[model samples]
Target: MSAQTIKGLTYPYPEPPGKGEWIEMARGVYWLQMALPMALDHINLYAIEDDDGWWVVDTGMKWGDTQERWKLLIEGPMAGKPLKGVVCTHMHPDHIGQAGWLCREYNAALYMSFGEYFTARALTQEDHAGADWRVIEHFTSAGVPFEQVQQMGRKFRGFGAIVEPMPGSYTRLTDGDSLAIGGRQWRVITGSGHSPEHVCLYSDEDKLILSGDQIIPRITSNVSVMPQEPEGNPLKRWLESLAYFIEQTHPDTLVMPAHNTPFYGIHTRLKALIDHHRGHLAAIEDACREPKSAVELFPVLFAREIGKDQLAIALGESIAHLHYLYAEGRLERQRDEQGVLRYRSVDPDHCPYAPADLTDEDVPMEV
Candidate 1:
């Protein structure tokens, strides 16, 4: 895959490490790519060399030959170094799926932020199935057709399907925590919205950061309103994270993200991500002058019209942007005659939540 240098950010490593192969990004930090069984295929994992062993960050999705690839790396590129610990950036299946198995394999400890660890544990224990009316109603409220929503034969137990059972206990990594491995200091820089308390690691001496999903050099991360939290404004939290990262991160640091290849230009990329959402907020706010449901606002929100395939994610993210404005009183919400949630922009806004200046460029609106 070719990495695009958007908004002045440059890809230092154009060719990603293929399959079980690995590339050294720094003195002891190595980059490895693993396959995923989806359109946006592939996740990047890291192995930081320690004196006695190694520390892994962001285990790949528990699908395809991901486990086999892990075995290959452990036996091959890793030279059979035992894992010192497994550090997950967040609770996402792709990032934390193999955490349990890895920890068990090496008798290593698990480390994550409080929110990520607990949320993932909760998902593994969540019990809901067989046409839960609440779920159908939630989709309907977002203006999805009853027939289309009914097409879901059964709700898939997604987390349990992909993720190994979560570890009962974990060493919590807070925002300012520092992890010392291989004589290099990596500071934990946490951000929210993509996932609660997403942990990123920054090393000023090495001039690189394990940005995770918080700062992808290529495509933007999805910040959506999940069905569980219908009124949640993750986009607000997502927008707030830009400035947080800008202040915490150095502009020269190379970003080792979970998805795309390693890249540089943190401040520009952060502002660009901020503006991308700001553009989304602006487009929908303009269209919301006429009351529209989250689903109905897709035309102005996305570069291409969404279909049933894209409905679930598109609707969730659309609602997130709307909720951000609505919560700030820039927009007001009311249900339509069909009982679908509709939003309308309020007159001249005085919101305290002022973000960075939005670019005039038309940012692609795909979650």
Candidate 2:
């Protein structure tokens, strides 16, 4: 990928790390890139040097090549010293997929937020029978065709396929916790919406932030309401989390994110993400001038085509926008005779709940 330059942010690395090579990002911090077979083809992992060993963050999915790459890393640049610990940013497979394997291999402690850890455990438990109707039911309720629901159900991806069996328990990394690594203290900053209690590490001494998926330079992290929490307002939580970051961090902090090249201008990026979602919420409200199902708002909410692979996530995000508007009183939701959920604009002239005049610092707390 080409180098990314924003207002005050600069991506020093023009290209990402190759198959078995790692890039030295700073004095003691190393960057590793792992392959993923998806629209987003890669994830960035970090290694912070410590007195005993290196502190690793964000393992890639449980793919065979990824395992091979890990082995190579162990014998190559990371020789002699062992892993001090493994810190996962969230419950997503690409972030914690190989946590079990890495921790077991290096005898390192797995550190993550409780919400992410428990949620991952719940999803990885495949003992339950039958197809998981959580997603199917969610789509069905959104006015999706019955045949489409069945098709999606048959191809529905689960946690086990991507994430390995998690360890029985993990060392919890709470918000405001300080982790001492390589003679520097990295404070844990937790955020919600992308995933519950996602951990982002910040070091004032180093002038850097390890932003997992909470802040990505290229794409906005998916902030959709999942079936697990049907009424969950993830968009609101996401906006609040962004507000927190903008309030707490500076504009020049170098961000080492999970997906794109590490860059500066964190406040700028955070505002962009917040603005992007607010724009979506506005589009959804306008599209709901007439009663419309979540699926019907896709064209207005998303710029590209919603293919089979992207349908589930796209629908969830669309529903999240609708739910946020409904909660904000900008839209009214009702169940049609067909049992499909429909949303209509509550008031065109007066939208008391609409998040207007949404300056980065002035975002409503209710958002």
Candidate 3:
């Protein structure tokens, strides 16, 4: 496939590897692809051949066919490489779903951040026969009809359904932790907003990074406020994470993302992600001219029609943007008579996404 360039970023690999196939990114690093049932149809997995064995990064969901595929992969593309360990970027089911089965199959240890491991472990044990009241209340407060909310509560599912049982112990990976694998030294860098302590592996010598969901080339990772933490400002932390990447990463460094094709121009991609969210925040703030429920502003923030399947996430992202503007003092929130929470612009003249201070050159003229 011929690579295409857009927006100052270069996609060196124009097309992703086909199912059950692998692409060698470097001498000992390989990219693997798997199918997903979600709106995003595929995920990219990475494998690094090390001295002892091969370490797999981010296992796909625990589908019924996954085990057979892994078996075939071991004998074929993996070259019968003995498994080293599984490195999970976060607690998300799509990333860590097969970690346990893979580790047990290879008798390898599990590597994850403490927060991710513990949080995932707890989720695996939850029995949500009915949805948690907090979750129902959180959605209701955003103007979701009681009937729809009740229906959600009835068919609630927990993480355990998709995830295999976790191993009893794990090796914790924190920010700045250096790991030796496949002759490359990978430094673990942790970021938040998508999930707690999302891990991104960086090889400074090779000028490459396994960016996980933190720096995907196309879609911006979802930064949400969970039902448990409704008042949190995850967008603030998300923006800061992007700023850090833009400042710290070199423009030429290659980015291997979890869901998109590998590419270069890390600086440009990171800034573009920031600008995308900035646009969302500004539009949402302006839409709050009159008091509006989070559900009501969905039209301003999202382009597609949201159905029942998308309700939870739709509400989450809406509240995430709303919370950011509210915390910035550009929007004020209150509860209506129906107990639905609504937000309105606090200062009509204020720009929610503007820089904190304006220099003389930035002052507006009658252009």
Candidate 4:
């Protein structure tokens, strides 16, 4: 299979900003790229000019260098003005890692969706017995290899390490709520599956949106079945959110995504995301005709080699695809004697044959 592409998706800016520097995206909006120690190497954080100071959206990871970069920005381009507020798109560490520090530095308020704020707070607690146990059991049920599980435990960053000290309280940003920044109103649009209540900001005046991870151009957002909600059908919620965006947003609006360069053609990206998940679900359903564990379906769903460090996320995503089919009545999941869940297609006659071997070229790079 060929890699998926959204035809109209075009990158106007060919280059990204260097460390401690920013590029103007719109009249009052500037974009900054920060380094991350992961396969996904960088995150795009935005700053909008506020009447009092700059209004920042999405804080980068909590690292010493990231902190020093913020300091340099304050003394350089962001000099002489205080940050009006810090608006986080979601609870993910890369998005809200330095929120507390920024709020303290500028005496700015922290704004996030209620779901994201409390979720972050809950994950930060060291003694959350329920959360910790759920993660271990989740992997075991998915049939993750023993050594790979150990590697995952070591690689995954705990919430506290990634997210710095957070404020005791935060102001909530709800769907449809409007925030006045840079003399214009930006409305809040919330999405799920990638994270709980992910926020995307839209400005009617300029037809621009700070579409934080909701409509990325290069890669599909990771929509996994996390430990906190083992049986949750996030794929269903994700498709609904995409439908909402496709139906509501204008095609002319320029979207500034969290991961990739900003681009236009919101409808094109949204449709591609929906189709991608649907294709994955169909593949999983076909592979389940003879009953298969989540681990067994990895090859059918993913073309890449899932390393030890990536096993946890890979398993979670595989389970997510299985859950979507099970939820839709296209497949049924049952536990075996060993207590591992296995799924089989509900209609074997119509089940598509699982491909024998998928080469690197056969799998979409985004998946």
Candidate 5:
């Protein structure tokens, strides 16, 4: 797509930051916000002063303009201290794209959850550069039509542009891991579905949580199922993660999400997100009373106007919800003569595809 078209979608094109403009949250902690081209709008990367030097929470996308902004921040606002380390919230391009570059420039170590690190490496591996074709073929094998497969190919080409390379190695982190940064102990909290091995950092001393995309104040995070990794019930895992997060974190904690302004009331926000997904699932199930493809369900799920990037996310989310319902036996699916899978809800009272009880093992966490 053309740059003009992409900009029209309200993607933030970052401009260099001026001097003395950084927002300091706590002792030796600051926030640098950058614009994103996706529906998420913008992302906030936190700068924390470590014992050695400095640590960054997440980096923005790998766009030229974003790189310039980072250059300004490093040379201007954070000029005195050397960057110590980097931490990625997840494998998403916007969060992890600049990690490798930062690590190389500062000679810093990168730390991420084991799952996130491996998943990011796999996606960015040289061998997988043109693997979108393989993904298209996989869906085709699953009975997706040739035309839809071509459309998917177009979507895959944009993936590399959004993400930058990752570091060669990373220190693997897990749930309950503690790290001292900015003079505070931050506990690692894990969540999935939004992205595999998504980590949220919570500091009890300051009641602040670096939520990444797990718990946004505005707009729900996209939970999708891609061909490379099918059988991913992102919606279910997302809900479970939200419940767990709410249970673990205090309601009054300040949530510094990657997108949108930092806010409080984690439990209330979690409830709203859960309700949003439940409503979408019900709407998809209702629409599936008559066989419908994921493409057809996209407009219904996202009635709001969307650009190509948003459309891609909407389609994936629709398919994800459809797959979840199908797995739940609430819907019956079959491939048509054209090799496209069609889905229709099964009547619980009379249809053979009656709903069945699902257990924790029945639904697995995926990104």
Candidate 6:
């Protein structure tokens, strides 16, 4: 890709809220503010004027405070026009929490990739709120102490607050599908690991991409292996997804992410993220020269001052890295009778392991 492709793409602070004031990115694209209680702080929800009406991308959390904010924006700025539909980039609570309310209130259709929809339903379905006891058993069998497993069970119930119920029906989008919004054709580019079948929209006409959490300008999106997918090596899939995205999208595309500022250099950012994970993998491999439990490796992967919520994300991320390393033969995994997975490094020369060599061609261009 030529460097010129990324030129003229500028990052501007989103327009300030003035009752119903809206900032235009393209001719009809606008961003609405949403509240988040985290160091990351806020999520930017985009609205695109469609032939039918308005289409919204990503909803904020389902808290009453955020719902009230949406009510104000809808009643004021978008009061007259019909909201045609809602499209979620992924299944995270910050991205899909308000979906049910919007669909019910406006009678709008909801769209999401099939995988994400299934995963979202599985997660938010009542009676499925808590952690899987089998997952704790797996960890304990692998050698984690029973006390730590009990602590994890106690903390797992909190996830319910973030993930609200999803709408029963949704329009499924696949790779290569094109949707028109604001008179522009936005092509769906599917990615994985962060969330199953996460779709990032790209418009070649203006070189603009609604990157979702796929390609954030500031921090790398979290790639984790949770209890539900214990054998998953999400780090490997996430890195491959980044590389695939850079190769397919124009280098100069203006990336409007779900969070953080819009910026240039999508390829450069992808490179940085890949390097970041490689470094993390290497660090963990070195640490594993001596046997270490997931808890012991936690501080090495994240800073000590992390908040409880962040620590939870960090824990999953660390486990993902370990899983990837173990899969590649750089680390060895063992399970004790109690069922916890333990890890230690293996000599490269003696170990029967090979990393999967993935190239741009290996990545699917569409869902």
Provide backbone clash counts, one per model.
0, 0, 0, 0, 0, 18
lDDT of 6 by residue, 166-270 (tens): 788999998889998878999999998898889988898999888888987555677877767777888888988988997779888878888766677787777
**Model 1 weakest lDDT span, ten residues long:** 358-367
Per-residue CA lDDT of model 1 for 72-113, tens digit only, reads: 888886775788899999998889989999988878899999
Error of 4 at 302 (Å): 1.3
Model 5 segments more than 4 A misplaced: 1-20, 38-41, 126-134, 137-145, 151-154, 157-162, 305-308, 348-367
Q: Please, what is the TM-score per model?
A: 0.92, 0.92, 0.92, 0.91, 0.83, 0.85
Q: Report the poorest 10 consecutive residues by lDDT, candidate 5.
A: 358-367
lDDT of each: 0.80, 0.80, 0.79, 0.79, 0.72, 0.73
After aligning candidate 4 to the native by TM-score, how far in Å is the CA of 66 from where it should be?
0.7
> What is the C-alpha RMSD, rounded to one decimal, of candidate 3?
6.4
lDDT of model 2 at residue 364?
14
The C-alpha local distance difference test score for the whole of candidate 5 amounts to: 0.72
Q: Which stretches of candidate 6 lie above 4 Å from their native place?
A: 1-10, 14-21, 128-132, 138-145, 158-164, 305-307, 336-340, 348-367
Better of 2 and 5 by TM-score: 2
- Candidate 6 at 60: error in angstroms? 0.8
Per-residue alpha-carbon lDDT of candidate 3 for residues 39-130, written as tens digits (9 for 90 to 100): 77777889899987889899988875666767778778677568888999988878888999999888988999998999899887776777
Question: Where does candidate 4 stray beyond 4 Å?
Answer: 1-4, 127-134, 145-157, 348-367
Question: Tell me, what's the RMSD of every candidate?
Answer: 3.2, 4.6, 6.4, 3.1, 7.6, 6.2
| TM-score for predicted model 2 compared with the true structure | 0.92
Angstrom error at residue 345, model 2: 0.9
Q: Write out the backbone clash pairs for model 3.
A: none
Locate the minimum summed-lDDT window of 10 residues in model 6.
Answer: 358-367
For model 3 the TM-score comes to 0.92
